[model samples]
Target: MKEQKGKQEGLQHDELGIKIRSNDNPYLSADLQKKLLQPRKLSSYFIVLIESGTITYNIDLQDFTLTDGHLLFAMPNQLLTPPAKTDNLKYFKLLFDENTLALLPQQFSFLVNPLNAQTIVLDSAVKERVIKVFGILNQLFLLDKQETDTEIILAYLNTLLSELNSAYFKNREPVNLLNTNLSKFIEFKLVVETSLTEQPSINAIAEKLALSTNSLYRIVKEYSGTSPKDYFINRLMTEAQRKLRYSNTSIKDLAYELGFNDPDYFSRLFKKSTGKSASDFLPRQDLSGE
Candidate 1:
């Protein structure tokens, strides 16, 4: 939860980079809880299933309250922070690096944007199946062997993820051609992320995705409630906020680093996007005073 750089205690891993930890782990402690509640970016994909209790978390500045029979996901590099008070929390956390995900037999289209959906509500039947699968994964990671049985682990892992994918789509709208819409949206996100620094035009992105400008606008708004242009600007500003909070980069350098030709324009855009000035976005040194 504290964005573990390498291996962590009680974090069993394989050469494939799969890691798992649950509420039952002895290494889960108060400090780790504190870290979980603080804003941090992970180096791996993180998925947590809430078997019981409730907690409100912020995923990319969007608030989501997850309780029993709910699953949440945080992609690498996204900001994840929860409130500190979670005495009743009980959940299972699974972390796997990109390489591990690549080894999967299929692609999870949901991982691309996650659709601003931090949590998925599971019905009772699905919840039971989810728990059983998580149990298998937890046991696999707790083995005492020198190396994990990758084949068996991957089989179960694939089953678990496949079940999750099915469950995730189940609760969403039963629209016609969901796969097509989802694919285009995912491609749009990829283009936005990859060309974020260059401040790519919406039309260019639409062309790259083989989408008409009107179609791109409709798809983005349908999925994320924002236009393509606004979404791009927001992503850029989010990156700016991340740098301001976690790095020592100055405003001018940060602006240029984010692909802004004019530092003053970047500053103005930041202020407009965040409703706060550049200096105001910086991390505060005195927490007690705040």
Candidate 2:
């Protein structure tokens, strides 16, 4: 993947607050392609569906190889390194900020839990439909200004997201979301993500959720297959890796930015969680040689 500074992350933006760029469009200029070849944090939600290509990119320090018929996602603040050199790399990318997401119905809960799986392989059936939808979206994206463009584009985008949400969890174990414990489990994930920097006590989080400490532990373990403290530590380590790879921030400043009062303790925790010291977790060439 390509490495570059953060400010170059947004290759396309508009008053509609959404951007779509694809190999299918003539407007995909060489300048935009160069920008995409850098390591940076996206300031908006990003979705990429690969139709026929094999490429490797790093997302949050985890390298993902997206081949033909694969879909990958990254949320705001997550680190992304552009794909390493490749041949026949055809894909459609959609980037939209929170303001665009807010325009949709609230039923799209899948956005909150995207980290559960960053990549998924699409079967032929799903791939065909997805391609059709992307085609419509690309058309709307390329259209000249019109009063209804934004609304029509948003509608297509909403449909695409709805389809993706269903496919995202299709293979995972089915859980009754209406069950109280399961509902609380979802809430726990939200709480952890929102206050990750603060590193609040598990007890404090449980209290805020009106959950007893033991109940909180049980819910987290059952849903995530890990203890609450371990989950928080993992999230912190992931963020630390992102900073180390993409930002020029020093370790101490990075620790403070993540709400750690003791940089030393954060360092120790990071090493223990990832088996790599902060300085050593930097990006390397994609093993596949692109």
Candidate 3:
């Protein structure tokens, strides 16, 4: 069942919790495309592979322009704004929820995005393989739910994610799950995301992760290129920017809502982090516009 919640259209599905769309086959209607162009929070992990042509997407307030063989991914709860026009784009888009991910035998670390890069540029060899996998999955999804073998679908899905995970980390240092420091860093990031509103102290976070403050500092710096305190502050500022750009919340209320004791201090920190005051940072045009 599809659900439209406020300005965000929730892409809910049935028990399978999966959907696929392509340029020609299973085409997207104009009305549905228009709805997708609006800024909305996605309830499922979204992936788009651009076979040809160009399209610009605004994801979490950042604009990314994708061309041939370019792939863009957005995690659940991210605000996405599709391009206004798709004149010549040939693409395959896939949406699946966390439930689908849990069924996979192995974990995909790129989903957590430790590298912080959303767009992946696929080389010729990898691009051809990816297209074949997406084509197979698209054909499988065309079958009726009752007739479709769920196991086959899962197998293809696994292959697609494996290809993506490998390409995502292509030239970068491989994500080694066995590395203790990397594992700790991922855990640290998860904790910060879940407890951002509390403005948890660095010492508290280190203790919770079962690492001393020094170890936490080293781990965070190695992965994120910043001190632990700066990383937390940057995360808070990013959330603040998202709220300021989307909602009509006042600065004082927003500051308090973000767990700041002093609005004035929050204002100063915001400026220091973003180089602009909160009032000046508000979007000139409402991103949720029709």
Candidate 4:
């Protein structure tokens, strides 16, 4: 929670692009702990492993409670509102960017969050292993940057993610990395995220993915439980909500910025998607505690 001029509000790391903190960390002073109560726009992949107690976190405007043996994952660009109280909370928090993730030996499909489940309930064995890995990573991070071995850190990181990935998918339909339809679905999501402002037509996206409209619909439906068009619209509305919450841009400008030719049309679409007006969707000053 160190303050950096002109930087976004959040817990930032050193030049190594990774940070790990636990309840026992001596560096986590009282003032720093107080700062954690503020809302932050996450710039990296973040995970919180709760060892004891319970607290509710507001992520992207939704509240999720975590107690002992629970893990919460938040991806980049999401809004993270930490709990106001942590006096009894024992937790280990980890943050790493995409650059660090790319260095890993294997792809973590759960990082993409295909199941849309962010909180994973860890069993006793997995909880102990996760805590041990977190403690090792914390010790590694505490060492001087020059003395620390990046490879060792990565190896532990890989192991931690592997464990979490297994627990995240346990008792659920496992994701097949080699499944062709799933691959296409992921690619489709990437394409949508990249060209979201362009608001490309479903046919155009299907063509780009080398699939017919019907095939695209089936693929998206199979993966996301929605048609391709609805999926795109939902993504757009989500983006609109993010901007409205984080930035001071007006509705008209936001609409145009999001590729809507007419602000009124965008207004109607937002209402239909969110059941609230764009202005009403903006974060309240009192609630935000700004």
C-alpha-based local distance difference test score of model 1: 0.75
Tell me the deviation in Å of residue 277 in model 3: 1.2
Model 1 off-target regions past 4 Å?
1-13, 26-40, 82-85, 105-107, 113-115, 144-148, 171-181, 285-290
**The 10-residue segment with the lowest total lDDT in model 1:** 1-10
Pitting candidate 1 against candidate 3, the one with the higher TM-score is 3
Evaluate candidate 4 by giving its C-alpha RMSD to the native, one decimal: 7.0
Better by lDDT, candidate 3 or 1 = 3
Candidates in order, TM-scores: namely 0.77, 0.77, 0.85, 0.83
TM-score of 4: 0.83
Model 4: pairs clashing at backbone N, Cα or C within 3 Å: none
Scored by CA lDDT, what does every candidate get? 0.75, 0.75, 0.82, 0.81
List where candidate 4 sits over 4 angstroms from the true fold. Answer: 1-16, 25-43, 77-85, 287-290
What lDDT does model 2 reach? Answer: 0.75
lDDT of 3 by residue, 208-250 (tens): 9999999999999988889999999987887788778767898
lDDT of 3 at 5: 27
Kindly list the per-residue Cα lDDT of model 4 for residues 1-290, writing each as its tens digit. Answer: 12222132231234557888786573355577566655677889999988998878788767888999999999886778766555687888899998778667777888767788899999999999999999888877775545655666778999999999999999887687668898999889889878999999999999999999999999899878899999999888988887787678999999999999999999999999999999986765533322
Model 2 lDDT at residue 36: 61
